[model samples]
Target: MVIDSLLVLGGLALLVLGGELLLRGAVGLARLLGLSPLLIGLTVVAFATSMPELVVTVAAGLEGRPIIGVGNVIGSNIANILLIVGAAAMIQVMHPPRGLAKRDGAVMTAATLAMIVLAFAGTLFWPHGLVFLLLLGAYLVGSYVVERRSGTTEPAGEAAEALEAAPQTWLPAVGLVLGGSVGLVIGSELLIEGAVSIAKSVGVSDAVIGLTLVAFGTSLPELATAVVAALRRHADVAIGNIIGSNIFNVLGILGVLALVTPFEFTSELLVFDIWVMLAATALLMAILASGRAIGRGTALAFLAIYGIFIFVQFDTGFATAVQSAVGL
Candidate 1:
């Protein structure tokens, strides 16, 4: 058990390092190819930070533990909203970015709903995955077009200027990409092994571990980005990041998992957890569309809700615990 814990910690560290290197290398390569920094920031960077989740989902699917993949996506979405966005708002009142709710937020909610419909069949196969990929592609292309037409400079302009200063040489960039990929593959393997062992030891379902441990592990990048953005008074950026992440977690990661290995989700997820994810997405949509600042009060509510959600996953006495904690 201790060894498994070590493996999980070690794997998490490597995943973070690997993802950072991959992002830098990809951005450098894009720059070398004459891609604009805005494109790099909006597309490459968003996709890059999500690589950890992608790797884990694919790994879990291929290992015949497909529940973990689905749970990871569901859990990550909940964490993105209740945890990441909440923490960011606690740092600063997050005002909605203009038109984000109408577009990306709408898409995110749609994606969550779409998953519910698809997963109701007990299994989602490659065809379903293909459709999801197509939808994701449409979303990306449409976003790029709309952003271009609007001439949005701030989003393109203020996307971590340091990202532009990547490796100038092809050799180093290639090395980073290769090294990062290797690390991701190895890290994912170790994480899965440890997670499965931990699940057995704890007498919890694989889905539960996936939702909490693996999901949080993959979400580290998003959390760091949101916190840092909050400190810099760029809370909107953090909110937008969470929105994009939730969409990708559903469409991109799950789509890829479907293709790699189609498997049935546990009833716990199809019935309960997915609905929780949908509720979070809907709540986020309403919050963003309100065009008001999300302050510390909202943050505390989100955190409290998330705490309850996590506790319920591990304990049968959730209602009693909540009552005791809230003095109700």
Candidate 2:
């Protein structure tokens, strides 16, 4: 157990470091390739940052533990709202664009609903993955065209902000890209192995570990990004980053993963966790619709809810009771 704990921690560290390097290298490569900043931020940066989750979930599915991947994606979506956004809001009130709820939130909600619909049959296949990918592609292309026509400056500015710490030279960038890819592969294998070992030792399902520890560890980068954005008073950035991550978690991570290896969601997730994710999504929409900034009080409430959710995931009896209540 102790050894497994160390493996988990070490794996998490590598994932973060690896993800950072990957982002830098990929961004540098994109910039050098003459890609626009908006294109880099929307495509390369978004895909790079999500690599950690992408690797973990896909590997899990391939290894016959599809539940872990499903839990990771679903848990990540919940945490993106309740944990990452909440923590960021604590640093400063997040004032999203007035139209964000209607536009971006609608897109996110549509993605969420799509996930639910795809999973409703109690299984996800390559066809489902195809649908997700198509939607993601359309979103990306449409967003790029709209932003380009509207002359949206935020993505370019955000790209510049992202580029500030990245390597400027091609050699270092290429090296980092290769190294980051290796790290992510090794780190994901270690994480899955450790998480499975710990789950067995504790008599918990892999789903439990995936939903809690694995999910949180994989989300570390997002947490850091949100926190930094909040500290810098980039509330929209913090909020937008989280929202974008959530959308990608479904459309991108689960999309490619399912195409490679069909995912079989666990009974645990099919019952309660997915609904919690939907509830969290709806909560964010409600917040956005209300036109109220996410202040400290709201942040505290979110954190509290996050704490409760984590606790419930680990308690079979509590989860059973909740499931029963829902079934009723």
Candidate 3:
């Protein structure tokens, strides 16, 4: 069990390192190809950062842990808003645009509401997949449309950021990406195996692990990125990283899973975790709409909320199962 835990942790480390390398290589390649930074950020960078969740979800679904696959997405998004953004704010001030609360926030809210509605409707199958994909298409098209209407060569300040990268050191970048991506897959395989082993050894369910460890493990990059962005006073990167990553976790990660696994929604998920996810999203929206930018205190509040949620999730099951076994 100890060995398995070590392997899972080690695998996660490699996954994160690989993802970072992939991002660097991808940025260089995009620049060499004359792709705009916003294009790269929105697609390449966003996808690269989200690769861990993508890899892990596929692994989970393939391993018949579809709950983990789906739960990881919800947990990661909640962590993105609470833990990641909160940790970022603890480092520096984050003044998200009021427009973000109005626009992208609405989009996120819509997605959350849609998922809830689906959950209430019973199992999420192909129809849910189609809806998710359609919304994803709309988002991509909307971004493109907005960019075109602005009539700007790049989104505001994007051009300046594009020129800031070093020259195309594509050779090493490619090597890193390849090595990292391979390592990520290998690591993901090992991590899932270890997590399952540990869960069984300790008498925890796969869903619980998905809600906590696997979910938290997959979210390490978001936490790290947000922390760094906050320290650098790059709150846009922090906010964008969280939002973009969440979108990809659903639209990209789950999209890939559906393509292969056709995830089946479980009563366990609807009863236990999905409501928490919706509440967390709503809380984030409330925070965004508060007219006050996220600061240290706001971040602290998020951390507290997340901590409470985690405790409730674990404590409930632990009490029920362990107490029942003990004839309590």
Position 97, candidate 1: lDDT: 74
lDDT of 1 by residue, 53-110 (tens): 9998998888888888888899999999999989999999988877889989899988
> How do the residues 1-328 of candidate 3 rate in per-residue lDDT, one tens digit apiece?
7899898898788788777666676667777788876566556666677888888888888787877778788888888887888888888878876666676777777777777776677555665676677777778668766666767455322223433542476786677668768877887887788888988888767777777887898889778766666666676556755765677677766667776676665555666577777787787778778867777888788889889878876676654764465455
Q: Output the TM-score of candidate 1.
A: 0.93
Clashing pairs in 3: none
Backbone clashes counted, model 1: 0
Return the top candidate by lDDT.
2
Q: Find the number of clashing residue pairs for candidate 2.
A: 0
Better of 1 and 2 by lDDT: 2
Q: Look at candidate 2 and give me any clashing residue pairs.
A: none
Better of 1 and 2 by TM-score: 2
| Global local distance difference test of model 1 | 0.83
Over 4 Å off, model 1: 153-162, 316-328
Per-model lDDT = 0.83, 0.86, 0.73
Error of 2 at 81 (Å): 0.3
